[model samples]
Target: MVEVAMSNCANARPTRCIGVRVLGVSKSIKGNPVLDTVSADFALGRVSGIRGHNGSGKTMLLRAIAGLISVDKGSIEVFGEEVGVDGSFPMGVGFMIEPLELWDEFTGLEMLTLLSSLRGKFCVDHLRSTLIRVGLDPNDTRKIKSFSLGMRQRLNLAQALMGNPRLLLLDEPTNALDEDGQETICRILRDERDRGTTIIVVSHDREQLDRIADVQYVMSDGRIREV
Candidate 1:
């Protein structure tokens, strides 16, 4: 169980070290500002949580960092290399956005295989291990199509662990998980941190954030401020 103080504390640390730096980042969609000159430095190997009400631009920031979306202004850097707006950064990131989608026809393992093929990197052993780590049974692949909502969440988490991504961006990772699934996620995230992966989580769950996050940012009206 996570210590009660962890939820209230604003600072915590995981064993791994991964670094992020942002400067003057801003974004506008169709003339409406979504992010305005946001800047912050994130310690590598630690979990940083982003909390905000709906429409606060948390998703945009994660997409920008993952090179999935463009920023109209400002810059993002990982480890010392600038992540240009153009998707030139190497595929060292794993991300999960809102409205998670999965094929009802494909088994969980099949989905993993498909994603690995798309990324041009396949590690079957690693993939199976990740699935197991996230509380999924490889043998259960055949039943993935029939999995419950919580099972689907575990499948998604397993996919993100592929390639041992250097950075991970997750949005409401525990939204559909049960207590056990949530605990599994926390353990996997902690293990990833031990391996030096930088994790950025966007969620409104204060209790979950307190358990895993080393720092927290609150977003409102498309602007972000550290808390």
Candidate 2:
């Protein structure tokens, strides 16, 4: 967890060690500005939370950090390496965004297997254990099309956690979950932080953020400020 406040230096750089750095990041969509010269630092091995009303650019910031969208100005760096310039994306990143695209024809286990194959690291046993860890039955052969919203959310989380990423970007991770499910997700997030994963979460639930976030920020009018 973040234990110290980072210094506001003359360079506008964070003094504490950082996992990711956003320097003057700005983005516009169809001529409407979404992120306006946002600057922030995410400390390594800490849980950072972003909260905001709808269309405040919380999701857009996460997307930009995840390398899913291009920024119109400034730069993003992960562990001191600039994204898109150093490489396409930061190493060991896991993310879950809305409209999760899944193969409706494939079983849940099969979907995990396919995604794991892309990384060429995890095996069948690893995938099965991840499924169970997320409270899903690995043996269930039901196609993804048959999954309910909550179940799909769990599956999405399972996939994000499959390989134990070093950086996690979760947008509304508790959405569609019951109280118990929410607790389970929170527990898993804590465990991940304990394991030194840098996590960035975007959620509307202030209580949830208070529970898990080591540092919190609020987004408004295409800008971000710590709170």
Estimate the overall C-alpha local distance difference test score of candidate 1: 0.81
Candidate 1 lDDT, 1-227, residue by residue in tens: 22333333335442113367778999999999988998877767778999998899988888888777778889988766778735676358887876557888887888898888988667788778878888888767465668888888888887788888988889999988889888888888898877777789999898899999989999887788899
Give candidate 2 regions above 4 Å deviation: 1-16
Candidate 1 lDDT trough over 10 residues, lowest sum: 1-10
Error of 1 at 190 (Å): 1.2
TM-score of each: 0.87, 0.92
Model 2 CA RMSD to the hidden true structure, in angstroms: 3.6
Best model per TM-score: 2
What TM-score does model 1 achieve against the real structure?
0.87
- The alpha-carbon deviation from the true structure for residue 16 of candidate 1, after best TM-score superposition, in angstroms, is 14
Predictions in order: lDDT: 0.81, 0.89
**Model 2 global lDDT (CA atoms, 0 to 1):** 0.89
